[model samples]
Target: MAKQVCMGAMMQCSMGMAPSSLVPTPKTVMTSGVMAANIMDNIPIMNIPPFGMCQSPSNPVVAAATAAALGVLTPMPCVPATPAPWAPGAATVLVCGMPALNDSSKLTCIWGGSISINFAGQVTHDIP
Candidate 1:
């Protein structure tokens, strides 16, 4: 009797498809998977911080190849008599295509490499 009823239902379903169960569907599953992937892709971009703004100077500060040299090379508010690990102010660095330093320049430490200022001084940067 049960088999007969199932066969009858199958025949009816073949003629006109029965309604799907009111539960999980393929669209819901695919949407969830895509949403999960999208969330993961966004995480890394959010973790990135703005250029030249690190928690400490020890961290790398990635910036454009060309920017205001003073802001990119040194800390704000000029301090005299201090030699930066990489470059120092009042020391000649190529500014606006000519070697110059204004009163606004200050001691600054770059992550790596050294710079020598002619008729001035030299700065060495030691990177770990």
Candidate 2:
């Protein structure tokens, strides 16, 4: 039988290289349909490009695992309404942060246009 590893235990463990532990504390925010991107709450400000714009993990391994474990934890790619507009619909946006304690009250959007996108999944800070 395959050994089962509990994500909670790993996260809580004192392991040095644990990817999950590297994630910063997440915060919840409400969308106001504003043009400015809502900065991720309680995370280190590291400009890592694309992912940095959304305050996601700069490490590829951590990023992939985080995305798999916590669905919609990263910004998604979207076709812009124009060729190169800085508007919300014109590009990908990070409307959600790392899930915590089975809650995702932080999920939000800033897309200001007639276009709409749908994402479905549960949030969990636990990573396996």
> Residue 121 in candidate 2 has what lDDT?
21
Q: Which ranges of candidate 2 are over 4 A from the true structure?
A: 1-101, 112-128
The sequence of per-residue lDDT tens digits that candidate 1 reaches over residues 30-54 is 2212210111111111211112222
Clash list (residue pairs), candidate 1: none
The count of backbone overlaps in candidate 2 is: 1
lDDT of each: 0.20, 0.24
TM-score of 2: 0.14
TM-scores of all candidate predictions against the true structure: 0.14, 0.14
Q: Give the per-residue lDDT digits (tens) of candidate 2, residues 15-125.
A: 111112112222243222211122222222121011122223543444575588775445333211212211222122343432222111221212221211111121236
Best by lDDT: 2
Candidate 2: Cα lDDT at 63: 59
Alpha-carbon shift of residue 123 in model 1 (angstroms): 54
10 residues in a row with least lDDT, candidate 2 = 1-10
